[model samples]
Target: MHIVVVGLSHHTAPVEVRERLAFAPTAMEKPLHQMLALPAIAEALIVSTCNRVELYAASKEPDTAVATLRRFLADYHGVPLEEIEQNLYDYQGEEAIRHLFRVSSSLDSMIIGEPQILGQIKTAYGYAVEFRTAGLILNRFLHKAFSVAKRVRTETGIASSAVSVSFAAVELARKIFDRLDDKGVMIIGAGEMCELAARHFVSNGVTRVLVTNRTFERAEKLAAEFQGRAVPFEQFTDHLASVDIVLTSTGAPTFILGHRQMEEILRRRKNRPMFLIDIAVPRDVDPKVNNLDNVYLYDVDDLQGVVQANLKERQKEAHRAEAIVNEEIGQFHVWLANLEVKPTIVALRRRFEEITAQEVAKTFGNHKDLTDAQRKGIEAMANAIVNKLLHRPIALLKRTQNETGGEDYVDTVRELFDLPAPAVDETPLEPLDDDTDNR
Candidate 1:
């Protein structure tokens, strides 16, 4: 059987197209079973996330399977095939293996090194298992993919640093405060960035959160989500001294907090250090506030600069990850090649042994006068001859299994020996000891 993947990712399709094609996890069983019902599909798994939708399958006829999957995706989603056909890509055999490893390792993500894709793949594999769509090849393939991802994470620093602006701001906060357990965070707006940064702070051990927005109700709604207190927009400065970290993203054209107001707030706190982030387009905090003693101020551009630098660092680490993926692909290819040739090897050996036994028995029948010891010696000689004659061909089959025309080589040998091709087994394999956790 051949491994194949057919799908569209963020690189090939827009969110609107992806969302339409995506399969809900709760509803996966039906589609997975449907995919397995197709003529060429033996095992199937679907991975659907915000950025991509893909189907991974094991098939005897991969080219036919790819075409069938494209039609299945369009028909299943009630979409016109022409609408999505151009976006669909298919990879078979080794290329399919490479694509899966890269995806599991997060190298194929829009933001390389992001960890969510790995978990998403794991969840998708779980659905395949629960629905009985993953057979031996897919089960082993996914487990191998997971191990490759883990190795990439451990050997390289791809996910070691913050690359998003909101997370980068939190990283900056950690550098200034050293420990956030005793620190309080104050968000000056109800914007998405402010909410995300606040979440990052809270997750990083910030104990208190204060929220204030021009719309008091919005502030209260956001504060309730974080279990924080909502302060009135007009009286926000009154609560400033109590907060060590402040994230501001309001719509005010002029600076909301000026140099003089921060000086007073500093004095109220006995000149304690403060971290101020101004992510607003119009500049919420005064640029001059950065000059104040014990105050670390950053604007949108500053945070973006940090994000860009970290992204560059991540790109460097991604090169290392790519190398790891390449190395893993070779290893997986060897295993897959062995799997493909195993049946042929068994049949070849069985054919030779059968011929050896038949010729030896015929000789014994022709010489009935021979002693029992002589017959045993003749049988032993025949067995040794069969082993010696079959050794070279078997070794050749194993060694050439991963090369081009490997399947043709196996077929030719089977035909030359008049050995019938073995039937493909569809049974699921027992779980390996190492893959027991579904990690």
Candidate 2:
């Protein structure tokens, strides 16, 4: 069987496409069980995140398995196959292994240095294991991916900076305030991006958070999730003077806070420093407000520039991480190639023993004059002959176990000896070039 990956990510598909194929965390068991029930799949793992939705599986026919998963994805989500197939990407064998390692190492992330993907993958793997959908190959493959991720994290500075816009905003906040431990933050919108930035501030030790939105209940819901207070929309600026940071991402067409409004607000607080991040596309705050003394305003483009600069820094370390993954892939491929070595030896021995027993039975039945003792001696001699004849070939196979084309050696031995091919529940991944006619 081959290790195959089939799915789409933020790189290949937009959010709408990804969402259609997404698997909810709480609803994984049924789909996992269904995946294992497919003919081509042996072991299965599904990773669904905001940025990607991918299915990894072990199967004898990589193409067939990929097709099966593609159909499964559309059918399960009640989406038309045409809608998702165009966005899907697939990999097989060594390439599949490389893709998974890159994903675990965060090099495949939309934001290269972002660290959330590794944990998300781990959680997905946990679900597979819990549901018993992940068998031998997948369990081993995911474990290797995790170890590679750990190595990348410790050995490279890939995740050293803020790669996401929300995170960049937080880093800038830290830079201005020296520390966020006692800083007050006010979020003027309850949108996803706004909430993410607020959560980052809270996580980074912001002392307080106050959320406000056009719909006051949405503000209340988001504020409760972050363990913060919710301020009414009209009265939100009443506490703006008290906050050291402001994040706004509302959909309002006009500016919510103007330069004139901020001038009065700044006076009430004695021109204290305030960091304002306008992540909204429509511009939540008036551009002229930026000129106010002690007020630093940054829009989405500025935050993206920070993210871009950090991404460039991360790109430098990505080479080191890629090298680590390449090294690990070689090690894993060796282990995978060797899976057939021992099983083939055992099957070959069993085949020889079976041949000897059948021949002995035929000879004993024909020669009725032979004594029981003589028959026993003949059987012992036959067993020794079979063992001695097979010893050299078995030893040679073991010695060359780490060499490429070890499967070739096994296949040749089976064909020369006319032995039945070793049976396996799931095939370990093999490079497609070396994957022909092993059976």
Candidate 3:
């Protein structure tokens, strides 16, 4: 089965289109199972993040799998198939593998080199593994992707600057406060982005955290996880004055924290500096709050600007990382191509050995007076002769099979030697032991 990737990302589609296709964490299981159930799909994994919704699958017919996935996405999202098709991008075979590697490494992220994508990929992979939808190919591919991501992060400067909006908020906070250990951080909503920002703060030594949500129970749960205090939605304004860093990410259709409310909090805080980050789509914090003195209010757009600047710097390092990926891709291709001729090489060797053994046995039957050790030595010599005669041709075939457009050469060798085609097995091969060295 060949690997195929079908999806749209921030680079190819706007947020509106991406959001329409997004799979909520709780809602992912059904669609993932459905995709895996497709006849053409041998294995599947779904990576659904805020900016991208991609399906990576091992399938016999990649085009058919792509159509099936596209239909499934359109039907699940209640979007017109035509509309979804226009924004979708498809990659197959080597390109698909490269795309997955790039995405896991954060090279394809909306904010390049942001570390969140790697976690998201791991989460998706874990889900697929739990659901038993990802088989050997996907498992190996994702594991390699994870390793490549770690390598890129360590070897490149792509992750040096914070790029995501949530992390950017933390970066800005560090710039304002000499130390975050004494700061009080208030998360206005129990959303994913808000949770990420809260985690960033907790990791960076923020002392006190206050989680307020529309639903008090959800707020309490989120707060408990972080060992923070939970406050009701009504008390958000009351707690604002105590917070040094306020991050708001609510799905409210209207503004939850307006200028008037923030101005009152500013007065109560005695003109102390405040950092407000609004990461919501509709913007929970009012845009007018930026006009307040000593108030450093940033919205999604502003955070995106910071991310954009970091992306530019990351692009420079990305070129270097891309060179490494390209080299690895070529190596992987060579390995894959050589795999196609391995069976033929094995069969050819077996054929020569069988002929040698048959002749040795017949010759030995007439020489009954010969000692057992002498017979064994003669058999070994015959085996060695067969190996020596076949060695050059076998090595030449393997080398030529690794070249570009080498499949034709492989097929020619197979046809000339009357070698049977190799069977495809998902199971890994066992390592050779010392006893098997004679072969």
lDDT tens digits by residue: candidate 2, 140-163: 898888888878988999888887
In candidate 3, what are the lDDT values of residues 1-439, reduced to their tens digit?
Answer: 4689999998899999999999888867788898898879989899999989999998768789888888887888899989878899999878987898899788998667777888888889879988899986687677777777777878999788776778887888888888999999998887788898889899889979999989999999998988999998997889889989988888899998888888899899998999988888888887888899989889888988987887788999998778767766676666556556676788788778778989999989888899989999999899889889988888887778767556666667777777766664565633311211100
Error of 3 at 246 (Å): 12
Specify the highest-lDDT model's number.
Answer: 1
TM-score of each: 0.85, 0.65, 0.59
Cα lDDT for residue 333, model 1?
Answer: 80
- Candidate 2, lDDT over the whole model: 0.86
Model 1 scores worst on lDDT over the 10 consecutive residues at 430-439
Error of 1 at 230 (Å): 6.4
The segments of candidate 2 whose C-alpha lies over 4 angstroms from its true place after superposition are 78-83, 164-166, 169-304, 353-388, 399-404, 411-439
lDDT score, candidate 1: 0.89
Model 3 global lDDT (CA atoms, 0 to 1):
0.82
TM-score of 2: 0.65
What is the descending TM-score order? 1, 2, 3
Candidate 1 TM-score versus the reference: 0.85
Q: Which ten residues in a row have the lowest lDDT in candidate 3?
A: 430-439
lDDT per prediction? Answer: 0.89, 0.86, 0.82
